[model samples]
Target: MALPKAHRLKSRHDFQAVFREGIRRHSSHFTLRALKPAVATEPSLDTASPTANYASTKIGISISTKVSKRAVVRNLIKRRITAAFYQLLPKLAPGWRLVVIVKPTAAESKCGSQQFLQELEQLLAQAEVLNGHS
Candidate 1:
């Protein structure tokens, strides 16, 4: 199943803002970057409620060619990461922009699901981006 629209970070500007202003947390397999959402000067026409948009969280995942030359491998990594995020969704705090970048070592080593979940959880915790004690 696909992630909700509110959870997927789709725009270049949003990605840029997160990358530029976000706090970084590193793990063995990946790096997590996150920034609290900023107030928008203008409301988007696509969404009926600006408050809802502002209150939701968004995420972006990146698996570069440097990590894996094969598209299949990169996609597999993305799927793993997305699946982990899906499981962690409820625990994540809202109104934050988050990005996860897969590292070269992770692609080369072919890390397992357990490792992925652990690394992601640890990174998010260190970043202080998760809600409660996740």
Candidate 2:
């Protein structure tokens, strides 16, 4: 299943903001960049609800041609990444904008979903973006 719209970073501006302002965390397979969304900088105006105070995490996945010259491989990587994120969403901290960039090493690894999930979890932990982590 696809993630909800609120859980995705869809626009170029959003992606650029994350790239420009986010903190960097790296794993063997991917580099995770995350920025805690600022209160004043929120792009969405649907903030009157009490639940809106607790912003949902938004994620973007970028797989460049350098990682896989074939679009099919790149798309597969994207799907896997999204699936991994979906599994981890509830456990993840809220209000952060995240970008996961697949590295060449990741493409070469040809890891299965479980291994990809493990790598992603490790990256999230190191980035301190996961709940119950210091």
Candidate 3:
């Protein structure tokens, strides 16, 4: 299954912000970019709750043509990566932006979802984005 809309990063600006300001964590097949939410400049309307606008963690997956010329292969990789994230969602911290980039070697290696999950968990922990990491 795919991620929920609220938990998926859909904008080009959001992805670019993460890529520009996020910290990078790497594994053999993937690179994870993670950024904490930016503080709001304007005052929130709800005076009673300062974090009313706080959001859950949002993620984006990017699979380049360099990973595979065929769309099928790239999509398969994306699915595996998404599944991995879906399983880990409950354990992740909130209000973070993340992007997962698939490296070319992943397609060549033909890794499975379990491998993706393990590597992803490792990367998240390394980036200190996992819950309880702080």
Candidate 4:
């Protein structure tokens, strides 16, 4: 379950209402964008096939078996990511569903927690989420 809304992005429909749609680069940072027609309407709403757009992004995290294998570790990653989101949402514009995929290093290393957070901070910064922190 998600933590109580720092401010709910609510549903994908709600996300569509404001989707600043961005993508994770090869570098793993998100790029910010304005709403496009593709970003605004659900495939069902759009009368089109459900082909995910690449130029845009959804914050989806992957905590793989390689990363944790343990349910508890995966849950920890989720909590960490959500906490980061709560702290950053004020600065994030609307219409994004963040999916944070956890790396193996995220759970196996002693310093993984700090590294995970730093990587998150980097991604959020690249996405411009902190540009308007308030």
Candidate 5:
């Protein structure tokens, strides 16, 4: 079964966790940033844990209405982000919650599934989220 909307953790938790833990994230900023620390300092770390069993990655979306109040564009961005997760998370470890902050730039990127996958590939490589690929 997949995780429901209310159940996933958005990337802001990373910012909060990083702030609270006194750790800095090794990040990849695409108008947005992916900040990561070596170890988590809060209970949420349990969510980002990497184990052997299959697990659904928790995702967060922070697309501001200022970017586009239209539901269609917002939904499209959400769908794109979700699609990115499904394609990339398997190549990563299990049980990690990722926060994806969308900038207005994402509203213009015409990336396909493979492009999105490649973006994720680069992201994981930078965040050290990949398995052996890391």
Candidate 6:
């Protein structure tokens, strides 16, 4: 299963914003970009709760053709990365925008899902975006 809509970053603008404003955390196979949500100066009347709109973390995955010429191979990498994110979702802090970009070296590596999970967790921790990482 894929990440829920609320947790997935689909807009090109959102991706660009994160790329422009987010901090970068690197690993051998992935480069993580994380942007903390902007502080709301005033509570909006449109929502009953002040924090309702920014209560979930949003993520995007980018795998370039340079990583793999074949769609199947690139898709497999994406799926593995997505699965790793799914497992770590609950531990991630809310109100953050994140993008996971796969490195070209990843395509030639023989790493598995577990390795992806470890690298992702390490990156998030380094970025201080994981819960309890303050």
Best candidate according to TM-score: 6
Off by over 4 Å in 1: 39-54
Name the runs in model 2 displaced over 4 angstroms: 39-52
TM-score of each predicted structure versus truth: 0.86, 0.88, 0.90, 0.53, 0.60, 0.91
lDDT of 3 by residue, 11-76 (tens): 999999999999999889999999987777887676886764467999999988999999999999
- Residue 76 local lDDT, model 6: 94
- What lDDT tens digits, residue by residue, belong to model 4 across residues 45-86? 644644444322334444567776689877877677766655
lDDT of 6: 0.92
Q: On residues 1-134, what C-alpha lDDT tens digit does candidate 1 reach at each position?
A: 46788789999998899899999989888988899766666766756665763477788997789998999999888888888888888888878899998889998785787789889999988987788746
Q: After superposition, how far is residue 38 of candidate 1 from its true place, in Å?
A: 3.7
For candidate 5, list the clashing residue pairs, or say none.
Answer: 10-60, 11-99, 25-36, 26-36
Better of 5 and 6 by TM-score: 6
Residue 18, model 6, lDDT = 98
Q: Where's the lowest-lDDT run of ten residues in candidate 2? A: 44-53
Weakest 10 consecutive residues, lDDT, candidate 1? 45-54
Rank the models by lDDT, top first. 6, 3, 2, 1, 5, 4
For candidate 3, give the lDDT. 0.91
Q: Candidate 6, residues 60-115: lDDT per residue as tens digits?
A: 99999999999999999999998999999999999999999999989899899999
- Stretches off by above 4 angstroms in model 5 are 1-7, 10-15, 18-56
Cα lDDT for residue 23, model 2? Answer: 94
Ranking by TM-score: 6, 3, 2, 1, 5, 4
Candidate 3 residue pairs in clash (backbone atoms < 3 Å): none
Off by over 4 Å in 4: 5-22, 26-60, 112-115, 132-134
26: Cα error in model 1, Å: 0.6
For model 5, residues 22-67, the per-residue Cα lDDT tens digits are: 3223322232233332344454546554542345545566678766
Give the top-scoring candidate (lDDT).
6
Local distance difference test scores for all models: 0.85, 0.87, 0.91, 0.51, 0.55, 0.92
Better of 5 and 6 by lDDT: 6
